[model samples]
Target: MDHYEQQALRELQQWQIRMNKKPSLFNGLTKGLQNKVNNVIPDKIHEIMTSAIKNIVRAALLGSEFTTKKEVPSGLSLAERERLVRERLRFYKKAAATEGAATGAGGLFLGLADFPLLLTLKMKFLFEVAAIYGFDIKDYRERLYILHLFQLAFSSDARRREVYQKVLNWEATILEFPSLQAIDWRRFQQEYRDYIDLVKLLQLVPVVGAFIGAYANYHLLDNLGDTAMNGYRLRFLQQITITPK
Candidate 1:
């Protein structure tokens, strides 16, 4: 293997270790707190949020609305493709941060609007990233992979490990499901909502909400970008045979 690929493989290994880590005491405590917060939230609101995520994600998977016009040029190296991916990620992070700041400053009503807007931005970014990785987002399987990556990035430690294992054996796992309808979207939405609920609640407050919103959105995107890079790296490296020296 080339120097850059070797470096990428090492990084992927470290990420795998992190993905497989057991939840710590702190993780358990935070999860408990988040669950309490979710419990206090009205079931109607939870239903609304879950429905929104399901519809938006389903539309993204089944439609071409988020597809990029720029094709990944043939024969680009992994390093080259990743450079473009990073550039796109930075752009999306800035856009998300800006959206978050604007909505946050406008009080609770606008803050509520951030959910769909931010989700669209994230899904769009993933589509662009998939293209850069030379994956055909037009394929349903690839789109499903995007959802798994999203779950991996935002779910709690235990759920993250479960999703990570599916990602690791994606080729086999994909076959077990007959269609996208087989996905447990209720669990998916709940995990994602619980994951972001704490920080997102702060965005509803007056004055300081703007700063919190911007920081949270940027940080979230940054985390997702790293997860996506390593997720794709796992697939890429696994597809090619690397001889040990």
Candidate 2:
């Protein structure tokens, strides 16, 4: 048509192109993060969860004898998720200062008690929180898939395999354990009833828990492993006092 119409058409086409590129751009970012974990700082995978003080406390408090009575959902609520991460970091720092200890080389022996049913409840909580904050996910499915990939890839295979069997060990007590397919739902509910209650309580705060949940889900379930790996790699990169000629 005219010059003005041509300009408008060009702008519209540019917007369309951007919209089309969005998914790939997001996936590329996700993949980049995943690569850092898979290739660079592979050791940092389980360290994030276990090297913290709160984790030890939870393990001690929950005890090896604890058992769930129902199916526990496989995610966390927002506030609880935030609390979980913050507490873990806090504990990690305190442990480091007090003990001068660090996450041991090679994956630590993590059992169901290590990851905990609370973490799963926290994940589900995060989903609701994201929704409350008007967060939409074109690439959520991709992120979730990638999260699983990271979990599977960087995780200690021995421990991973052990936990898979333990999921069966508590089959009656815990519900819908994370497997190739969803396990029993009723057990999942009973297993994480406390976490569910906490999620419900946090819901009373309107979108506060939801906001925390959204970020935690995006970070932990989506980006934490890769982020931790990247951080470690960046640290190593910065350690070069001199470059080779």
Candidate 3:
């Protein structure tokens, strides 16, 4: 490995160590406030958001339609895989930024529409990233890994660590991770929505909405893309240690 690849591997190891560590006291406090906020949200809105997010994610996990990701050339090295991943991230970031700008400029009605549209963009980008990493998204575990990456990005600090541990243990459990419906969809949706609530809400305001939407969506994609790259990196290096030479 050259300088960059060695540095990346070292960083990935450190990241996993951080991921596996238990949440700090500050994390607990933040999550507590998040819970308080979630509690005040109307049950009807919670139910609606939960139902929508669950259905959309379930479709991504179980439906072939979501896997329209074309085949990537196989047998790329770690550096090559990440190079491809960066390429995909660049494209998705711009698309998300543009979508956010358009919807944000359209006022509250269209700003509301950005939620689902942006979700679509995020999911599609995950599909492409997984393919570039040489994983078959048709497999249930890989799809679940995609969801785990999503949760890692947007969940509270406490849940993010928990989710990352799951990602680390995935290889051991992927074959037996139970049914998709077994997940706590309510918690998943609430955490995600609450995490982005304030910023996304700004996207609904007049005049400033367009800038907030574009900037928020752009950075959201940036964060998600980074999380995903490390996630796949974690998997790749772990497999390397186990593979028979």
Model 1 lDDT tens row, 197-244: 888788988999999999999999999999999999888777677421
Judged by whole-model lDDT over C-alpha atoms, candidate 1 comes out at: 0.89
Q: After superposition, how far is residue 92 of candidate 1 from its true place, in Å?
A: 0.6
Clashes of each: 0, 28, 0
Best by TM-score: 1
Off by over 4 Å in 2: 1-22, 43-118, 121-245
lDDT accuracy of residue 83 in candidate 2: 42
RMSD in angstroms between candidate 3 and the native structure over all alpha carbons: 3.0
Which residue pairs does candidate 3 place in steric collision?
A: none
lDDT of 3 by residue, 62-167 (tens): 8887785466887888888888889889999999999999999999778877888888889999988888888888888788899989999898777887787788
| Rank order (by TM-score, best first) | 1, 3, 2
lDDT of 2 by residue, 49-166 (tens): 3343234323322333222222323443333333444444444333322221111111233211223333533333333322222223223332232223223222332333333233
Task: Report each candidate's C-alpha RMSD, comma-separated, in the order given.
Answer: 1.9, 20.3, 3.0
Quote the positional error of residue 155 for candidate 2 in Å: 18
Q: Of 1 and 2, which scores higher on lDDT?
A: 1
